[model samples]
Target: MEVASVLHMNGGTGEASYAKNSLLQQKVMSITKPIRDEAIRRIYNGKLPKCLAFADLGCSSGPNTLFMTCELIETVEMLCRELNHESPEYIIFLNDLPGNDFNNIFKFVECFKQNLNTRVVGGIGKCYITGLPASFYERILPTSSLHFVHSSCSVHWMSQVPKGIENNKGNICMASSSPLDVRNSYYHQFQRDFSLFLKCRARELVEGGSMVLTLTGRSTSGPLSNESHYIWELLAEALNDMVLEGIIKEDQIDSFNIPVYYPSSSELQLEIEKEGSFTLNRLEVFEVSWNAACGEEHNDNSEGYKVAQLIRAAAEPLLVNHFGEAIIDDVFHRYQHILADRMSKEKTVLLNLVVSLTKTT
Candidate 1:
């Protein structure tokens, strides 16, 4: 499958758009704020650049697109204030695949800059924003240009579907019923993609540059036992129901596979070591509710519906490309019902892996 062409979140601010349903991703950014802040502090303390160029890879559309840019600017402003130092000029690169909603994000740029002019203390540094549509797996930036790089809820997506998972039928992702070969194929693909990611970033970032990445990951050593697997299982259940009803062909299910992998912390560490261009400073794992509506109490039905919307916004394009657009509503409706039943029996949560890294000199 052509992941870059088809794997974008639903665009625009419609009810099912990623813009409306990305509170869960925003929550993820919130959860990892301290780590990102610390990385910025270290970069500033170690070597403050005159023109700090930072890139947000896989910067999908929505409020979360510029969330890091704003946070980083605020932190630098605060640092400059505390030290009575001059604020450096800022250049922010918002990057994602070609199919991403760059137009939607750009619509808010001028407004964001105006806010910065008034909100940034002393109007410290002039900020520039640009939209870069490309894959992070390749070299997208000039060598040693970036001082700080941040990506959240990204990089878990492989560059393409693994080559030999043809037998992984009845499922769109890795599952417990998958054969050993299928699991190995997925892991090997992640190893290659992530290693290349590190190598490319090592070249793009300046010496002593810092990166903080947050990814959907598995808590346990076994890939299939994680919540992500179960989540896909639920979707597959919905798809299987459609197949039985002759709404979609069984071969379609057999042929479709999502190009995402949830690696364990150990797996990530190994890939980093093998790449040998960055030093791993911290790797933290945390869990959050799948519902995304934390702090408020909601019945299973409500929570389930919320989770379904979140996944639909992120997964709809890929599904539509494979199964056609006609079955989306019915499939998700069935998915919500299944998820509600499951939530009534037990809670569903997503495990996130946040890692901080420094480009080795």
Candidate 2:
């Protein structure tokens, strides 16, 4: 499958859209706010440009997109006030795949800018927001153009499905049941893709500019040991249940794989060192309960249902591409019951990793 063409969150502000289901991602940004703030502050102190340019790579549509942009703007404005320096003009790039919901994002631009002008203390400077539809795996910005680069819950996505995983049947992701070769194939693909990511961003960032990235990750060395695997494990179970009931064919499940990997901190460090363009300044690992971000607002929904909706908003496009749309709802409904049972027995938490980097070249 062409990941770039099919990989996008459910668009629009409807009930199932990413805009409504992205509280988890927003919570992650909040968790890593200190690192992101420090990086931006470092750049401002080192050299505050007349027009501060930055890009929110893999910035999917929603309140979370606005949240990141607002934080950046507010951070700069606060700094300017304390330092007694003139506020710099802002050039913010909202970047994502070509298939992303750029229309929805644009709808918020005018209103967001209007609010910024009236809300920020002492008022803010001129701010320009643009939609950049492209892949971060490739160079999408001019060399030495960005002062600060930020990406959240995005870089774990592989550019494409790894080759030679055809044998990884009965699983939709790298599971414990996957063969050794299948596991190696996934890791090798992550290594190549992440290394290229660093190289691409390295070229786009100015020397000494900062980058902060946060993604779903694992605390342990084993690839399948993370809670992220349980998401797919339950998904696989749901598919298997359908296969038994003749809702879908067994071969269909065997033929599909999710193009994502959750790397351990050691693995991430190794890739940064091998890429040789950016210096890794700080790395941190944190955990969040599966239901922590959604809160009591979703109390009417079962714990399993809440998590299912979150995954559906993110994974529906990909699932629809592989399986027909007919079985999408059934799949998640089954997944919800399975997850609910599991979570009831034990508290489940997702591991997250945040890293800060500096362009050295």
Candidate 3:
């Protein structure tokens, strides 16, 4: 499957759009607030620059997209106030796939720049914000132009499905039952994608610049850990239920594999070391309950429904491409029911890894 063509979140401000459903990711980025601030401080460190370059990679359209950019600019503004220097002109790039909804995100840029302008004690500087439609897996900007980089809830996505594991036969993602070779295929793909990502960013960032990345990841139990992959496991079950009802073919499920792979901290560390571009400064894993970000209580299975919407916003386009648009509602309804039953019995949490790294000399 061509992931970039169909991997975008549900667009616009609809109830199911990623704008509303991504509060979980917003909350995750909030937890890393200090990392962002510290990285900005490290960049200035008494010597304020005349121009600052910032890039928000994988910046999809939503409240979260502009919300993220504003935070970065605000961080710089606060630091400039402390240093008694004029706020530097910003070269901000909000980047995503070519198919992303750049239109929605651009609407907020004017307001973001105006807000940043008001706080500057002197006249406003040029905070140039523009969208660059390209994949971060390869070079996206000119060399050594960026001073600070930030990516949240991206980079776990592999550029494409792993080779030699087309069908994954009966599974859509890495699971406890997956064969050793299938697991290795995913790990190797992540290693290669991550190394290249670092390499590209290294070339773009000025030496001593810092990058902060927050992405979905696994805790212990290794790369094949079921705890980290329970969502997909439940999804596979939901697809099978649809098959039993003859709503969709079993072969469809057999041939479908999510183009995402959540890596363990060890795997992430290994790739960063091998890439030899950036030194890992701070790496941390946090456990977040599935229901933590969703506000409403779920005595009536509403929690399951919300979980389905959240995941659906991100995964539906791909599902539509493979299973046809006809089955989306039915498939997610089944998934909602399955998840509600499971949630009523116990709690499930997904691990998120937040890392701060500095470009090597």
Candidate 4:
């Protein structure tokens, strides 16, 4: 499978909105603290050796990444100090898809240079920011080197879309119909990618090292449902309107598909079990409340829409490929409208999961 960039609403050349969304940041930390704490505990108890390395996979650029990394380091550092253990030598690795905006991340690094020494007890540990794709974990870290790994809002995205879709008999373009096949294909790909991830990370994680991962997820036997389908459909409808207006060709829309997947906890558990090298420590579910791009409740004077635009910009390539560039703005507008309406009718919720696992010694 060729690794392609996943459509992200919060991506662009400048700053990402999610990177600045303090509310979202707070919510992420609230859900991720327990997982981080557990990983720290494992590292402190000799379950994972002390003075070992730590990393944050898919650590996108921005305040969010900096905030997350600093928080994780603080948590681990505090635990080590409390236990009278040598503060673990930390290696902060920030990874993302190849196309991620590194400039912003670099800027963020500069902002933290002064505070780094102050944050660590003994001295500032080695901090490095580098890029790594979702598939090629082997190249990112050295063998048997990492003690704790943390990832959030990542990993549900596949390296690429499933194969054999062009010839498939059903609605291959839309994720609503043929969900079983879609999910199965997605599961298979995740199984392969995750297996490779473990294999790569396994080489880098010393005996008993642990990983904490959080990502978007869905619950149901198979395929995403209609309620969940509204977002895509609204975008699709906007694209169709653009087509009618002679903005882009219909064929163009048909050629594009999102190369991502949302897995259920059961599906993930099954795959992890198959890996056979890690022990599941904990799994938890939560719903994140996201204000729509055009929510009336949002302070209209705020920078919320700018953040939404950034996310849309990141997703533009995929959206244009699928829906056509001509309809992109319309699609976004319609999506915002639909999202607002849905929120008005009832709260729109996004499902997410956080899991912690320890490598077998």
Candidate 5:
């Protein structure tokens, strides 16, 4: 399972070009709009159930999942009109990895029900989008029936691909180049996929539910250098320059890798306090500058070099399937001219964390 075969051959070209680039949808909805406005003010101050139920967990599929599900239903209808309550019954869901792109997220939920039948926010009413594929560490929800669980850039991804890197030789990831045996084998598979995603979202959350997790991490803790392991050494030097131009074959680069995992923030608060049903309310940390012109100087281009050329055009078909398509467009045009000459010499950085838990029951 080469990470579920590169998510079933790049899950519909990574969720249909995840909203055809609007500067990577404002760097993933500007860090997921303050964790969806603090999980709609802690589910309207813990009153909870209004039949709300939201879930994006690895959503991925066009128009940045309807622009982060219309900014999480306009921040849960402005926290149910500042807690007066009532405007609920809005289940969204939209997970991923069952070879996602659920028909382009159900055609972007029928263009979000024809743009909410002609948009009318403050007037409320309209946001029922649904499209669950599954694989959020695989429980496929439904126990207590969630109340909110957003996920950006998906849970530091890893449902596979860390298994004993073939008896470790070519470094089976722990941030390779062997840093303490690949960070104790990437923190033992990020503590077994974050304790089976907090025991399957704590049996599908309900008791004071709430979870917001943005990803792409690493703010020191050993290994991860060479300019923060520049995207796995620029995808293992574009698959060893496509196996030295023979076009894929060195045992398919020792049978590919990259299920990815990048925790921090005290190793994700020690796996959400050893899966005791969450609590951490926030763990912030931001720096994302994929280099282009570290924000500003827009007209002169470099929205992080056009979101690093839409993540190198959605990782160009897994970099031309282990580098081949004639040296995959000259190795992504020399990796976008060395990431735009290292953003004109200020180097680059990306880190990012953004937590916010809750659950506790």
Candidate 6:
């Protein structure tokens, strides 16, 4: 699949839109708030430039897109207030693939900027935001332009599906059914993609500038572990059921695989070091439910229903692109039932990785 052309959350602020369904990622942003604040604290301690650049990559449309930006502005504002330093002008870039719902964000962009100006500038510190549609795997801005870069719940997406996995049947992601070679293909793909990410960011960031990334990843149990692989396992089972009933072709299963990988903490560190561009300041790994921050009391849906909504919001675009919209409803319907059944037995979660880095060159 041409993922860049296809991959995006359900656009607009409607019910299925990522704007409403991204609470899980908003929780991630909250979790990493301290780390982000610390990075900004250091920047302020050194120098709060008169003009600065900040970019959030894979910043899919949602309240979380502007939500993160708000936190960033707040961090600088709070730090300057505490330190008695005047605030600076900001060139904020919100980036995602071309298919992202920039229109949704644009609808309220001027209002958002005005709010920031009123709160931060007081007619003094000017803040600007622009939407840049492109993959974060490549350079998105001029060299040494960005002072702080942030991305949450996005880096796990591989730039493309792994090569040489066509023979691995019935599985869309790395799971128990995947062969050893197929797993290796995913690992190698992540290595290449993440290395290029760090290298490209290295060129874009000023020396001593910081970056913090939070995304779904794996634990010590490795890539094939149940905790790491259950989401896809259930999804594949749902598709296989459809195949059994002839709702979809078996070959479609073979051809359609998700371009997603959850890397281990070690895998992440290895790529950063091998890329030889940034100094890894801190690394954190935490476990959050596939349904994290989602509460049963708020809705009547089953746990599986909630989880399915979360995954569907983030992944439905890809499913629609590959399978056509005809089976979209049926696939998720079966997927919710399968996931609900699975969650009934045990509470499973994803291992999350948060890394803090500073550009050295």
Clashes of each: 0, 0, 0, 3, 2, 0
Model 4 clash pairs are: 9-311, 10-311, 179-223
> All candidates' TM-scores?
0.97, 0.98, 0.95, 0.83, 0.34, 0.95
Question: Which regions of candidate 1 fall more than 4 Å away from where they truly are?
Answer: 293-297
Which prediction has more favorable lDDT, 3 or 5?
3
Q: For candidate 1, lDDT tens digit of each residue in 224-294?
A: 56466788889999999999999999999999998989998889888988889888999999998877742
Residue pairs of candidate 6 with colliding backbone atoms: none
Off by over 4 Å in 4: 5-26, 47-50, 119-139, 167-174, 226-230, 292-314, 320-327
**Off by more than 4 A, model 3:** 116-124, 221-227, 296-300
lDDT of 2 by residue, 248-304 (tens): 998999999999999999999999998888889999999887786475665535688
List lDDT for all candidates, in order: 0.89, 0.89, 0.83, 0.63, 0.65, 0.83
Lowest lDDT sum, 10 consecutive residues, model 2, at 292-301
Across 302-353, the per-residue lDDT of candidate 6 in tens digits comes to: 5667677788887888888888889977888999888777676776787789
How displaced is residue 158 in candidate 3, in Å?
A: 0.6
The runs of at least 3 residues in candidate 5 whose Cα sits more than 4 Å from the true structure, single-residue gaps closed, are: 1-42, 45-61, 71-75, 78-149, 159-187, 192-209, 212-247, 260-273, 277-317, 327-361
What pairs collide in candidate 3?
A: none
Q: How many backbone overlaps does candidate 3 show?
A: 0
Of candidate 4, the 10-residue stretch with the lowest lDDT total is 165-174
Candidate 5's error at 238, in angstroms?
18
Model 1, residue pairs in steric clash: none
